[model samples]
Target: MDKEFFTPRTLGDAIGVSQSSLKRWADKGLLNVEKTAGGHRRIGMEEALRFIRESGVTVVKPDLLGLGSEDLEVQEDELSSADRLYYALHSGDETRVRSLVLNQYLDGRPLYEIFDEDIQPAMARIGLLWHDEVSGITIEHRAHDICLQVLADLRFRLPRVFTKGTAIGAAVPGDPYTLPTAMVSTALRGEGFSAVNLGPNLPIEALLDEAKKIKPVIAWLSVSHLRKAHILRTEIKELARELREQNTFLVMGGSQIHKLRLDRDPYVLIGKNIHELVSISRGLVANIPQSSESKGEFS
Candidate 1:
């Protein structure tokens, strides 16, 4: 994809700063810029967005940067965040929902909060709608599509992870849900881990095969749907052992995983939510021994 670039003057105007100030900041390395063939300076859209977010600058004209051209400020007078999100998902308002979520992240809210606090509650309500009415199933399916679109956009805006420790994750076999595993990868990326999401319904063999190839620092499994309890437990036990042999930690989560025998150990970790997943993963990445505090949520 071609990168979008903005001139110093355009960015300055958008943020209500002068062209000279922008140029000076660029020269001082406060802002990143590139030179055109004609020797004029240009800032990539990512850098411009970064400056706007980190500097807490009010975008007077977001159109100049190809962001939300409409009102970006979230309306708080009428509905709660989760309620508003539910309405958007049910109504299939992709643009509005995208604005709502992307703006939250740009405002410094962590991805876990967006998942645990906003998307979780909203999706819970949506799950009910999937069976309540005739059009409910269609609405639910469309909502998933819209959510996937928004997630792709959000992932693009996430700062590229360049540090060490690759992490691989996937939804358990027979689990078709996409958001939980995707959210895990995104959250790990935010914490500077090279997260690789192998996607849903991935076989245990594939996960083990990939783990052997990459030797990821952390391997994650999300259990949103359990097709066969006995087989899945056996697979998870084996997966945990495979990871432990490589000195890798296994992190697992999702609502349907409670039935599994969660064990308290150095290499096997279970979480109730995305925040715990991040906490555990980062601890392992930093080699911060949490054996004292490492206990499963269901053990």
Candidate 2:
């Protein structure tokens, strides 16, 4: 798991500020901190990130926060993060991949933006490796696993609290790709939903069964590689109908989503990107009652 909290000195060091300055900010209530049982101060990642975003401070040492190294400090367009990520993934450098992702995340970039602008573009290029023969396929699979690792690290960095109602998702059977559904979970989490990723390659019947059991506020299906379009269409239609009956919105997306040729149903939503999915989910979450544990600092 990635580091979650930081002391005033550590955060100051990470951002190139003095402890005295950080303490001063805490004293002024500009930065929030919690005291340990022994009296030392600790800053949660949520608060530290908030302070950075609101104050426009540069993260000079994001690695201390489990993000990335000095390369993260460089301003964009020199190589472009997507380009860098493509090369890193192609080379199967898991550490570099993790750093690139965590750096953007701790820098307070939105999960949706990161997916749309960086990870997806890089992975799309990496996907071309499938045609490059067995060695290429091995590299592509390795890249996929590395990305999953980065997502896990990012998940750990998020606060343990999730006050929003449940938001569940999965990839239908034959769509073995996992990143899209996992990315959906992270984005919805960012929007304050308890996003439950049911994972990939689940049969439509099994997906419907789980959706019924979870009774989520919203359900998502990622269709990266669809098979038997007609059967899937029928299954998806039934899923949408069931979700609508429960007042749960059904959101679907992926490169192959259009193959479903979905019918006109108000509860059925089709998104072209993570940004659109989050936008819709955010609105749905607004109407659902927050759990008893919800707080002003909810993330």
How many clashes in each structure?
0, 0
| Model 2, span 1-299: residue lDDT tens | 45467988899999999999998988999998998899999998877876886688988877787665747445444788789888889999888888887767656778888889999999888878788677888888898999998887777566556666777889989988899999998888777677889899988787678778867778889999989999999888888888888778899999999888899898988899999998887777677676554333333
Q: In terms of TM-score, how similar is model 2 to the real structure?
A: 0.88
Clashing pairs for model 2 are none
- Please list all clashing residue pairs in model 1, or write none if there are none: none
Candidate that would win on TM-score: 1
Displacement of residue 52 (Cα, Å) in model 1 is 2.1
- The deviation in Å at residue 225 for candidate 1 is 0.4
Candidate 1's residue-wise lDDT over 71-155, tens digit each?
6444564777678788889899998788788767766778889888988888888888757687888888888888888888887
* Model 1 lDDT on a 0 to 1 scale: 0.81
Q: Model 2 off-target regions past 4 Å? A: 1-3, 73-77, 160-163, 286-299
Alpha carbon deviation, residue 126, candidate 1 (Å): 1.1
In terms of lDDT, the poorest run of 10 residues in model 1 is 290-299
Give the C-alpha miss distance for residue 195 in model 2, angstroms.
Answer: 0.4
